[model samples]
Structure formats: structure tokens, C-alpha cells
Target: MITPDLSGKEFKLFQDFILENSGIFLDINREDSLRISLFSRITAKGFRDYYEYYSFLRYDALGEEEFKELLSLITINETYFFRNPSHFKFLKEYILTPLISERALYGKGIKIWSAGCSTGEEPYSMAITILEVFGFYKNLNIEILATDVSLKALDKAKKGIYSLHSLKLIDEKIKNKYFVPVDKNRFKLKDKVKEIVKFEYFNLIKEPYPLIEMGGWDIIFCRNVTIYFKIESIIRVIHNFYNSLKNDGYFFIGYAETLQQISSEFLPFKWNDIFIYKKEMRDLSLEEKDVNEKETGITEKKIERKSFNKAILSRGLYSKAMKFFEQKDFSQALRKVREVLEIDPQMAEAHFLAGKIHADSHRFVEAVESCQWAIQLVPLFLAAHFFLGVVYDKMGQPQEAINEFRKVIYIDGDFGLAYFNIARIYQLQGEDEKSLKEYTNAIKIFQKSSSEKALEFSEEITSELLIQTCRQNIERIKGFINKKNE
Candidate 1:
């Protein structure tokens, strides 16, 4: 449906309200488009202005149904089947196969959550992927929780109907076997496929996640959800995801996502084209040994392991350096990180920490040098590449930024922020279409990476903040390119 336009004040009011309630920061320049979309809902509600609609939404003794209605109006639900195929491809190879093998070994079931199910295609797709993987293991108990805020959509999903267009590239046999003819041009998922999935309503932003408390899940698919959330909201939701997973459980996000900046507990590993996060498992063996020693009356001395000590010292120095840098104490931060290097020359963390301080202080040469050193210390240091990308971006070398971001993705395919950076650079270079693709990719990754467990360890990604902190960069690039052409 075509949305109606709103007046400037109406646009601002609506934007502010959404930002406050949903933590979705609408770009000021998107006022007109946002106004059109938001105004459509007001019109649908038979309201005259946004203020009235906002008042109604806010003061209607807000409840689940009301919030779901609001979310239905606000959430963008544009999605396609097997859209971004590489992520699913990776899932088939690296993630699903491994999980199936593990489930067989342990004689346990597998559980998956499609956090933003959106009319059921994504979750259905996930179930299909699992089915394809465990074709022989038919007795295995596998289930998918397909949840979304739109009950209306969920209603449609429960009907298990879809247009043929949405089934592009699906194997003929799988389609024939899994879906039964419903009408002239539609199909309903077969009972077998439908039985494996449970449809429900869920809101990522506000949650005591519905099913997570009942049991920990093996994998979560939350792709493309976080692009709409504000930074703080994104962190909160991600932390929630982290807490929801079992130990060593995997979280699958979009091809363009990463948790390196968002959560510390999640250890992101890239296989093929997808970024999956594994929750850190505590070393129960050591704890058990300590308990045993205590019971046996053995004095188990906790010796100061050099590697452990060095990590502690390095982290402390890195923390102090961050504070110094925040206070604009470049020299001191640099000195502190150098001391960290002295303690452990091979510390990539120290190198990255040093690189950040140098980059922030406008010491491009030093920043580049430090970043390069970090990259050399550990070529897979995604943060170092991100920092280097920032340095290049600041130095007015969009191409360089693009290169550095690409390198980051090469090292870690799910590096969402790097995709964001690449998108920004492409936008700067007048590649608006490409930039949009990259931005969407980044958003996709961010959404998929979200989990209850991830949310607990999720913190503000300083690099993301720095990268998106200003609106001036886009305008600056626009003018630069325009003038260059003239």
C-alpha cells in the first residue's frame, strides 16, 4: 500500500517517537520517506495527525497486542526465500552437518530459533536446511521456533501457504515432497515440514525471550533484525541472545554480520560465507580438579602462569590506554601500549589498542604503522583491519578504506561493521546501488548474530560508533565528488 506523506513536524514527531520507543534512529534525511510510511498507519487508524496516533499508541494502556500492532506498522518485513544464499550454503556445510553429527553422538535433539520469522519463510527455510542435512536421521528430534511480532503474519504462516515466486531455486523433489498443492497458484507446506516448526510472536527489543527460559537452543537465526535498532537496543538484544544458547552452541547471522564489536562472550568464527558465533564454555575439568584437590587435602598452588599474567597485564594496559585516548591522551596511551608490547611482542590486542589510539589522534602514518604491525602480528586480527579502514577513511582515501574493509571480511566473513564501512565508501564514491547492497548486507549480518547469550556480553562497539557517529561524511563526499566532476 502506498503510504501518505506527512508535514515536517509530523515527520519529526513520528521519528522521535519511534527512536524513543523502538530504538530505531531514523536518518534525518529519510524524513520524507518515513513520513509517508508512518502517515499510512495513521491513515489506516483513521487518525488526522501523527501526534494523535502517537498519543493513542503510547497511552492505550500498552499491552502485547498493542505493541505487536505498533511493531507491525514500524517493522520492515521485506524478505525473500534463500536471499543471501551464501549464508545458508555455509550453514549446510559447516554448521548443520556438525550439529547433526554431534546430536547423533550425544543422542540428543537439536533446537533452532528463527528469531524474526516474518511470514515463516526463513524458519521454513532453516527447517528445510536441517532436513536436507539429516535426511537419513529421520528419527532425530529437530524443531524450529519461528517467531515474529506480527501476529497477522503469524496467522498467515500457520496456514503454511506461499506463492510459487517465493520458491525460486528450491529443488523440485524437495518442493514436491515437502509442500502439498493448496490452490490454483499456491502451496501449503506438507504436514511433516509443518510439524517440525512452532510459530509464535516475539519482540527482540523487549524480551524475556519466550522459549529460551524453557531450554537453551543449539542455534539461532536472527538475520536482518538489528539494522532497525538503535545501538543500545542492539547491544541489549544481542546480550539476550548470548544468554539463550547452550555451551558451544552456534549463532548464525547474515553474511555481513559480526559480534567482535558487539559481544565479548561470543567467539565469532567464519566458515565459507557466514559468520557463526560460539558461546565460550567454562573449563569444568580444571574446576573439578581444584575441588578434588581440596577434598584430598592437597595444597594445589595456583601458580602465576606467564601467558595468563601477560594477558592480564596487556588487557589492563589496553584499558588504561583506552581511557587515556578518550581523554585525548595520545602520547600516554601510545606509551602504555608500547609497554604492553614490551611485555609481549606477539600480542595482537596490544597492537590493535595502540593502532586505535594513533588513528584517533590524527597520526595517520603512525596509525597505519601500528595497524599494519597488528595485522602482521596476527593477519586475522579483524579489529586491526577495521581500525586501519577508519584511518584510511579519515585520510580521504575511500578506496583504501574499501580495501581494508574487504580485507577484514576476507579474514572474517561476518564482519558486519566492515561491510558497513565498505557501504559508506561505496556511497561516497557515487556507487549508491552498491552502497545500499553493502549496507543491507551489514544489517543482515547484524540481525543474524543477535541472541540472548550475545546480549549479556554485548557492549557498545566503539568502532561502529566512530564510523557512524557523524552525518557530515556523506555530505562531504557528495560535495567533493560533485566539485571534482565540475
Candidate 2:
């Protein structure tokens, strides 16, 4: 039997249904992908058309089971061992190193949850990282819980078997240590690694989290999962994750994902080149106090409340500056930001805001200086680097601008606007191939983002606009390449 085509109206109906049931937002750009997945299921069920399948899934008694099948087919389960090595490195060095020492003092156990852990690679990677760092000491109690919405992925994870493709990043030594060769192309994870991780079916949007009642988690990893979720659903899920975390607990999202505009409860912390969020900032302050006392004999008890009052005053001034900046009142914005800087000279945010004001006022030199100051204060400040690139571009220093954008990418590889800007510069320079590649990269990121979500650091550009522009640029670049070849 021939597969019936999915109409535009039918696509929207299914889109709403999916979002309502699973909290996954299926954008217009993903209609083709959704159609492809639907075709097979439609055929398997011997349905006449897309509408019939949709109705059956929505109304039939077996609808729940069919929906699960649809989820298995549509939900992306692509993962590899040690997919993002920096995250694991940060876990070992910055988090676990200090954590184990602190917990050892208190005789406490460490709990880590890998949310949306597909095929067990991520949670297993955490297991290996923990084992490498602290070993299996009797005193060190560590619990690893991995959960996913897709039962198909969880089943595969529980089996502890993986293909060579999934183990591509693993070194020979690590492969030898943690995995046993099942065949030429398949490997079975050693029991030691598999036993530590407990895999479960968890719907982030639908399920009530019981783990929080058990004294909360020390760490949670929910990487590359929320890209498919609606904005409201994302907010709900993130709020749940926040509650499930203990005071000062660490939370890691996908490198591409951000908590900007979603939640402010977690403080963003950059460790080396990796960025993670912490539930409480007070712990960092206390940790810093301990370090300072070790180096210069400064006691935490000696810290004054006056400094805290100054911080509060500066924050109020910064808010006023941000309002002025948003209104495009550059002079007032500059004055307020300066007041903020006077109160807290080391406030990187104030400096960054000042840079924006200077840039808007066409004072390129001052803009560069302000952005540089912000970078000096916080080396991994992404917004500072991004703004510096914009200032360089305005100054007609494309090379310098490209360098700054590359720095932003080095810090956060999934920054789409950086790729978009780089692509535009390449297009202007007539580097068709490079421009096309960068445009494609930008599209990949922006497509995953919500269509209506306003991009960070941009005045008003949304993900939908970026995706459209990138597609147009890619097509133009391809056309230029074809003409040159002819």
C-alpha cells in the first residue's frame, strides 16, 4: 500500500497533540521529519492516511501504547560514550574532587541523576569518571540514577551492550578497562561499570519526582533533552529539577541549552572552559573564603555585612541601567552603569552593560575598552566576548571580530549567533564553502530552539528568523558556488 502524504493542517493537529501529551514542541521546520516517522507507523497500523493514524493515537484504547511507539520512533536516542569530555573532566576535577573531600568530612553519600540518559552512555560515563576519581572506597557512598522517557532506549541501556559507533570516543585503554569485546563491532559494558547505574523510565514533564524526598540530589545531568520541549514545559521541568537538587547542588544541561530567560535560581559558574550551574552562590563564597584564608590569612568571620549591602545597592543600580539600555537611552544607561561600577568596581555585568551603551553610542574605542574590562574581570564571560566581536566588526576589523567570535565558540561551542555572524562575514568575503558550512551550523542550533524564543544578546531576533535567514544564505552561497564552477 502507498503511504499517504501528511498535509499542513494534519501536521499542526499532530504537533498540538504531541505537545499536549509529551511536552515536545514540533516546529514547522520539523514537519518533514515528523512526516517521515509517521509514514512507517501509519503503514504498520494499516491506516489509510495521516489523519486516521492521528485519530487512532488520540482516541483508541491502545492509544497510549501507540504513543509510546511513536515516541521511540521520534525521540532522538543518538548518543556516544564520553560525548562531551569536558563535562566529565569538570565532574572529576572541580566538582568531585572538592565534593568527596567535603562529604568525607561529614560521612555523607553523593547522589547523581542523569536525566534523559539515552542508551546508558552518559550515566555510565559518570560512573567511570567517579570510579576513576575516588575509586570504590567503603566510606565513599555514591549513587547514580539514570532516567529517560523512551522505553526503547532504556531497554537497550539495561542490556549493557553497545556498538562500536557508540564507543567511538573511548580510547583503547578505556575500552580495554571498561568494556569486553562481544564481537568485532559490539561490546558489552563490564558489570563493574553497569552495576553502579540504575536506569528507569521517567517522563520529565508528566512524572512527579520522588527522588527529591530522599534528601535531594547532589548533581543532575539533563543534557540535549530539553531542545525538543515547549517553553512552558521547559520551565516546568527546570523548576522540578531545581527543587530536586540539594542546597549548593550542581546542575548540568546540554552545552547548547541555556537557563537564560528560563530561570535565575541557579547561578552560572564557569570552571576552566566548561560552564555549569550551581543551586546556591553562598557555597562558592564560603569556598573562596577558605581559599583566601589559606593564601592570605583572611577569615570568613571577618567579612563585613557592609560589602553585602554594597552588592545589593549595586544590583539596584544595574537594574536601572538595564532598563535604560533597553529603552536605548544611552546617556542615562551609561550614567547608571557607572554608578553601579562605582559601588562594585569588579562587577563584570556593569562593565558589559557599559560596553553595550558605548557600542550603541558609536564610541567604538570605549566599547572595546569596556568589553575588555568585563573579560578581564570574568574571563569566560560569553556576552562580553560576543559584544567585543560586534564592536570589532563595526570598527572594520573583520579578523579581530572573527577571533572574538571564535573565542565565544571555544567557550560555548553551540553558540548559534556566533556561527551566523561568522557565516555573514565569510559570505561578504566571498568564501562560499565556508559561509555555507557556518550557515548550516547556525541552522542546526536555531532549529532546535523554540521558534518564538528571543535569542540572548540580540535586541529582538527570534530563532525562527535566524533559521530562515541562515537557510536563505545557505541557498545563495550554494548558487554562487555552482556559478563559479560553471
Candidate 3:
């Protein structure tokens, strides 16, 4: 069974199909990966190409079975027990105690919905943590509904089998007590632990609460899963979760999944360095809303008639600086940047621009200082860190440059320049293997961004141009590696 390289059109069609059915956004860079997986299916069916395979899956009766196979390939079930222990720690110390007291007062059991509970580790882990913290599970009724879109994953989850990697973060005492060793490097969850979590095939985006009785849950653990969706789909899914929660009930999300950026339906509360959202309190009077907003730092004066003229002026100055910088007029750019800094001293972008202008004029010392200031103002500013790396690289500090590049990637994993520049640095240092790896990473990331039609970080740089350039660099590096070997 020969697996053909997928054409751009074919990849886009397949991407749309998957996203329409399940709210998973397969980035364009996954074309190669998808083609390989599709090949396995195509080979099994003796299909000629992806088009035929897609047709069969769309029209044929047995397409349902084939889709399950395809879904198992596409869906990333990369969760392990206690992956983010901070979340669990917050739940145990802050949430569970209140829940216990609240449940006692109400004479009711607590319900937890682990939306996208891939392979049961998360839900089961939650069950174990709860049992440990509560000290006697029999007294309190806790219903854990673990749901996933993939039937294959749900099946695996119900069996409760996991390898050593899944158990790596689990404490030895917890492991010995809650999980029994099944085979070498394999463990099966104890029945007592498994009984609490009921696994079901569920879709968060399309499916409304179809099966479960809507008794309202104390908490909903829908972490990490939302990252697979686009921002719009993410908003829809988060809204669905909002409706599912009881009033004032807590909703736990993974740190990586930025629901805050997508939706404002849930009220965010900081718990032990973990941000959990709650259903907005019902029937808050106007006064109460004002008080609530103020506590959250959105005060009356801060929100009402705030002067944007200064902000507008700062943006104008920044724009002028950028124009000058682009036109290779470093002195003029420096003047504009200074004007922006004078107006808004803490403007990270202005500081970053100043650094870039300084770098242009070979003022490495001033460049480094400006970049440091930018970083101090906004530590997670990707461009600032990236330029700082560039400044360091020019200043004969490879290690510092690499560190800043790494920091950029740490803040934003999708940053293409960081990957590409790091790869270039590695190539310069004769680290062929590392260079190739970073180059490949940059190519993959750029491919995805190209497919998305917008570049991340730099508004001016299109993903297509970046991808093409990265590809050329990759080829050059590869040729060099081959030549070096010869």
C-alpha cells in the first residue's frame, strides 16, 4: 500500500471534515502526519488514493467504523495522571473542603464531569485524590462522569490500564495503594478506584448534555482538551460548559487552554496559583455587579470614559518608529521610539522597537539595555525576548542569545522566528543534529501558520514567505549535513 503525499486541496478538505464533525483544528503542518495515518487506512482498504478513501468514509456504510480508526489516529490522547499537580492541590485544599461542607448542608452528593477524559487517567486520578482527601468515600456520594469523543479512547479508559509513563508523576504510596501492577511496566487501576468514574463517549462541541441527568455539578474538569479547538469553537464549548455548571460552581481548565481569551461567560477566580472559573452569581443587583467588577480590578473610573487619546498618540509614535525602522532610517526611528517611551514609559513594544533600532545602529550595549527594560515591563513579550536574543547573538554571547530564544519559545511555543533563529545559531556553532531538529520544528510551525493565513508575532511577516524561507534554510542545512558526512 503506497501512501501518496497529500495535495494542499486534499489536506484542506480533510481538515474541514474533521473540524466540522469534531471541534478539533488540525493545523496545516499536520498534512504530512495526516497523509501517513491515512496511508495506513488506505492500505488496509486497498484504496488508490486519499480522495477515494475520503469518499468511502463519507458515503459508504462502513465509513462509521473507518472513522473510528481515523479518529484514533487524529485525536491526541496525551494526558497522564497528575500531570498538573497544582490543579489537584488546589482542588483538594480549597475546593473539596467547601464542597464537603456544602454537600453536608444540602444533603446531596457532588457531581464532577471530566469532559474529554482521555483514557480515564485524569478522572481516575481525580477520584483517588478525592478519596484520599475526604478519607472515607462511602460516607459522601461522589459521581464522576468521564467522557471522551473517541470510542476507542473511551474503551481504553474503561479498562483502566496505563504504562509507567502515566504513573511517573504518581507517588509510590498512591501507586501501590490505588493501582495494581498488571504486567512489567504496566499497571491496572484498582476496581475500587475505577468504580467511581463512569466513562462515556461524549463530544463537547456538538453534543448537549444528552445522557447525564442535569442535576448541576459542583465542578467540571475540562482541562487541556479545549486547546484542540479554534477560538470560536473554544468559545462555544466553554459556553456549553458554563450552562452545564451549577450557579457558583467551579470550572477547572488547563493552564494552556486560554478560555479567558475566548469567552467571558465564566467568572475567573485565582486558587493557589491556578485560575478556576465559576458560573456568574445569579441575580446580582447593579450595585453588586459594580462591587464585583471593582474587586476584579475593573473599577468604575477605570472603565468609564477612560482617555484613549494618549494611547492613540503612543500608537502613532510607535507606528512612525516602525515606518522609519522599516525604511532603514535608524536615527529617525530612534527619535520616534523615544517619543513613544516619553509618553508611555512602560510600553513594552516601544522599548522593543527602541532595542531593534539600537541593534540596527550597532549600539549593542544600548540595544541590550532597551531589551532588558522591555522584558522587565512585559516578561512574556515574545518580540522583546527574541530581539534580546538577537542583541546577545551580535554581542558575542551565544549562550545568552540561546537563553532568550528559548524564553521566547517558552512563552509562545508557536513562535516561528525563535525556532528558525535558534536553528541558524546551532548551524553556525556546527551543531548539525540540533540545527536540523530546530529547523524541522520551524518548518512545521511555519507550515501551520501558513495554513492559518496569518503569521504569529510579527504582523508584517506572512506565514507563506516565512515557511518558504524556512524550507530553503532546512534544505541548505540538510545538504551541508550530507556533505559533512561525505
Candidate 4:
């Protein structure tokens, strides 16, 4: 059965509804995604159109329950054990180790909240790491609270049964020790690991945070969760996470997600190559004190000042790096960029600059690594994608280069230079028809832009210059086609 197409009005209604209820922002680009998610329910309910389904979902007596069903369909649940090994490594070495010692002294338990925990991998992974670090769970006081809005995912998590694909990162010894194979491809987590993690259904945006009565969480893992939220929603959620954390407790977000513009309440800390935020320690007794209270007054100012100083220092170093890059001093540029990264590892632009410098110096391997780091830090980084494409092309990997260029176009449809590069690659591969099509695309995009507008990355090439070059390429490709016909 075909799913009815969602009209723009209906799409907006659903987008608004999702945002209001769950704080998930379905942008204009996600129209097809929204449609597909609602398709099953729309068809199942015998609704002929999207509007009818939306109406039923909004007005019917069981609408709330139905909405939960919709959420299950739409919510992203892609995860795996020990994802981003650096985070887990940091957890064991930096976070858990110190906490174990301190908590041991105080005879208190370690509390971890894995907010937006999908299918239990994260919290379970944490439990595994905790058990490994402490050598056993019997004498240790540890609490792992894993929560998600997706009831379906939580159900699966509770079952503690997983496919081999989900355990891809697990070592053989660890896998054998922590899991019992249920079948050829499935494994059930050992009772020891499962017992520690408590999976619950809690919406980050709508539901009140759990376990606050017990005390603030010692650590919170909400990685990759906030990317779906709007800026305002992210702020609200981060604020809640901040309040829900003990002073000096750590907060982990996805590598691609940064709190730079969102909030400065938490101090950004680097653990090896990975960056995590730390809730600065504060005096709880001074909580009710007025701003005029001298000791407490300076605390807020100190945090702001520290954040300001770091920003200034990183920016200054980045400026120097850019200047060196422009001056063709690759070594100096690389050095300065490294300094920028050392100060602010989350600076995606610095990583991109470092990648560019490496590429310029003909260090393709280093260049690729740096560009990848930049992309991992900021997934939608256009410059990094473009530069990575260029590096791949220089390394004689035409298909890889094309893939990166296509990503640039995907991220920004009007990136005429990406089209131009793709056309050039096709031309080199002796594919005249494909080259002509991409050249035409380049010309069309360039024509829509101001003639004087400089192309991204290739700032020396204006829209007019690119359009003229594309036209020449189109004519050359046509000549090749005509000769083949003859």
C-alpha cells in the first residue's frame, strides 16, 4: 500500500506538534522523514491522507498514546556499545577512577544518568567499565539510570539481548565474560552487567528528571541526543542537566555537538583527545546568598572571565594560523593551529585549518585525519568536506573525492564549486555525459548568484569566472559527444 503524500501545511502542523511535545525540531529538509514516519500509522488507521491522520492523532481520545507510537517510529535509536572509545576510555581513566576513590572514602555510591539512552548500550557499557575499574560491583556503590523517550527501545534494552552487530566493538574475552550467546548471532548480557543499569522511559524535554531526590547525578551522558533539539530547547535541556549534576560532575555530549554558544555554565575540559564539560564546583551553602555576598559574587564572574580568556586565546591563535596559511608558511600555520586546538579542542575551524595546512604541505594522510577530526567535531562543516574532497582528488581517489563533493552539495545545494569539481572528476574519468550534466548544474547555480560573488574555498574565482569556465567545459564535453556520434 502506498503512503499518502504529506502536504506542506500538514508537514508544518506535524513539525510544530513534534517540537511542542518533544522538542525535536524537524527542519524543512526533514519533510520526507516526517512523512515516512507517519506512513505506517496513517495506513494502519485507514486514513486516506496525512491531514486525516494528523487530525486523528491530535483529536482522538487515545491521541496521547498514539503520539507515543508516532515518537517510537520517528525517534533515532542508532547506537552501539563502546561507541567513541575515547569517551569510554576517558570515563574509566579520568572520571570513574577518581570518583571511585572519592566515593569510596565517603562510603557513597557513584551515580550516572544516561539521558536519551537508546536500547541500553551506553549505560550497560558504563556498567561494564565501572565493573572493570573497580574489579567488582559487590562492594561498590554504583547506580546507572538509563532513560529514553522511546518505550520500544527501552523494552529492547530491558531484554538485554542483542545481535552480533551491536557487539561489534566488544573484544572476544570481554564478550565471552559479559555475554552468554543465546544463538549463533544473538547474545544475552550477563546478569551482572544488566543488574546495574535501570532503564526507564523519561522524555528529556517534557518529563521531570528522575532521581533528583536521591541527589544530583555524578555524571551524565546525553551524547548525540541534543542534535535533534532546537536551540531554545537545547538551552532548556542543558540547564536542567546542569542543575541535575553535582558540582564538579562531568557531562558528555556527542563529539559533533558543542555547547560554545549554547551555555557557558559548564567549564569545557579536555580528556586526552576527547572534550567533555565539567560543572564547576560551587559552595552549596552560599546558594541562597544575594549577589552582594562577596564570596559567592566572585564565583560567577570568575567562570565568565575564565571562559572569556579561553575564547580570546583560541581566537588569537587561530587568527595567527590563518595569517600564516595566507602567507604560505605551512609549518608556522600548522604550529599555530595546533596551539588553537590545544586551547580549544572543540574548535572545528581550527581542525579544518590544520587539515588545509597539512594538505598544502603534501601530507595527505595527516590531511585526511585532520579533516576527519574537523568533520567529527562539526558534522555539517562545509569547508572540511570541500577540502577533504580536494585532498582525495589529489591522492588519485576520484570516487572518494566525488563522494565528499556530493556531501558538500547535500549540505548546501547551491555549492556550485562542488558541482564544478564533480564535473571535472567525471571529465577525467572519460564520462562526457555525466560531466556535461554536472557542468550544467554548476552553470545554473553560478548564474543564480551575483556575478561578483566569490566562490567558497576558491575565493579567487568569482561566479562569473566559474560560469564562464563551466560553459567552456560544457562545449568541450559536447564536442566529445558529437565526435563519438560521428
Which predicted model would earn the best TM-score? 4
Candidate 2: stretches off by over 4 Å: 1-3, 46-49, 104-107, 137-139, 281-486
lDDT of 3 by residue, 107-139 (tens): 577888899888888898889887675333544
**Model 4: per-residue Cα lDDT over 1-486, one tens digit each:** 444677777788999999988899989888887888888877777777777777777888988788888898889998999988889987875567546655654667789999999999999999999866543465567889999988899999999999988999999967876888899999999877899999887888874677655568989999999899999999999998998898778899997899989989898866557788888766644553455356555565466547656765786688789899999999999999989889889776778888888888899999999999978765655667888999999999999999999988775676788899999999999998899999998888788722222164586776778888889888888888899999
lDDT of 2 by residue, 318-363 (tens): 7789899999988999999999888878777688889989988889
Evaluate residue 403 in candidate 1 and report its C-alpha lDDT on the 0 to 100 scale: 91
Q: Which residue pairs of candidate 3 clash?
A: none
What candidate 4 gets wrong by more than 4 Å, as runs, is 1-3, 46-48, 284-486
Off by over 4 Å in 3: 1-3, 46-48, 60-65, 210-215, 284-486
Worst 10 residues of 1 by lDDT: 449-458
Report the number of the highest-lDDT candidate.
Answer: 4
Q: What would the TM-scores of all predictions be?
A: 0.53, 0.56, 0.57, 0.58
For all candidates in order, the CA lDDT equals 0.68, 0.81, 0.77, 0.82
Global local distance difference test of model 1: 0.68
The TM-score between candidate 4 and the true structure equals 0.58
Q: What's the CA error at residue 18 for candidate 3, in Å?
A: 0.7
**For model 4, what is the error of residue 222's alpha carbon versus the real structure, in angstroms, after optimal superposition?**
0.3
